[model samples]
Target: MTKESLKELILTLEKIQLVLIQEGEQEWVYGISSIKRRLTDINIDSPDFKKEFKSVQLSYLNMTNGAGSFSDVMIWRSNVEDRIKVNKDFNALTKKTWELFEL
Candidate 1:
C-alpha cells in the first residue's frame, strides 16, 4: 500500500482502538499503536522498496531471484500455520517474520 493508504488504514485502526477502549477492550490499544509506528516507519517513495513490497504479497510471487515462488506458496511458507516450518528453516525465517508483520 502507498503511504497515504497506510496512513488511512492507521487512522481507521485508531478509531477502532478508541471504540475498543470505550468498550473496555483495552487489549487492542497496543495493536493500534504498533500499526501507527510501523506505517510511519516505511519508505514508500523508493522504487526498489515498492518493487520488493509488491513482490512478496500474498497475490504476487518473488521474482527477484531466478526461483519463482508463487504468492500463495509464499504465504503458506510464512503464515501462522507454517510457523514450525519457518522456525526450522533458517534461510527465510527472518524475511518471513518481517514480511508477516510488515506486508
Candidate 2:
C-alpha cells in the first residue's frame, strides 16, 4: 500500500479506539471486525502485520464474550490499548517498508 493508505488505516484504527473508549465494548466489535477486513484487503506478507492483526482479533474475540461486567470493561480497555500500541508499531513499520522501495 502507499504511505497515504497506511496513514489512513492507522487513522481509522485510532478512531476505532476512540469509539471503544466512549461507547463501550459492544460498539468496538464492529470496528475491530472492520479493521480485520481492511487488513485482509492490504494483502501484505509481513509477519509483523499478521502477528499484530492476530493479536487484535484475539483481543476482540475475548471482549465480545457477553460477559458485561466491570472486569470485562477493564479487559476491553486493556485490549484497546494493546491494539493502539500495535497499530502505532505497524504504522512505523509500514513507513519503513515503503521507504525501502524508494531506494
Candidate 3:
C-alpha cells in the first residue's frame, strides 16, 4: 500500500477499535467486516507485512463465531473474559501494525 493508504488503514483500525470498546458484540459485526474489507484493499510493498496482516485478520475471524445473534450474545455474555480477551488481541495487533512503517 502507499504510505497514505497504510496510514488510512491504521486509522480505520483505530476507529474500529473504538467501536469494539464502546458497543456490544452485535455492534462489532459491521466494524469487523469493514476492517477485513479494508485489509483486502491494501497492497503493501512488503510481502511479510502483508502476510502478518492476513494472519491478524484470522484472529478477527475467530471472533465471529455466531455473528452476534441473541443466542450468541447470551452465550458470549456469560464469558465476558473471552470478550475482553478478544478486544485486547485486536487492540494489540492494531497497535503492532504501526510498526510496519519502521521498515
Which 10 consecutive positions of candidate 2 have the poorest summed lDDT? 69-78
Which digits, one per residue and each the tens of the lDDT, describe model 2 over residues 58-91? 5544544567722233322258878677556545
lDDT per residue for candidate 1 within 71-95, as digits (tens), equals 1222123467575564344325324
TM-score sort, best first: 1, 3, 2
lDDT score, candidate 2, position 52: 56
Off by over 4 Å in 2: 1-9, 19-45, 69-103
Which residue runs does candidate 3 get wrong by more than 4 Å? 22-47, 69-103
Highest TM-score: give the candidate number: 1
Q: Each candidate's lDDT (Cα)?
A: 0.46, 0.50, 0.55
**Native RMSD of candidate 2 (Å):** 13.6
As for candidate 3, its clashing pairs are: 1-43, 1-44
TM-score of 2: 0.29
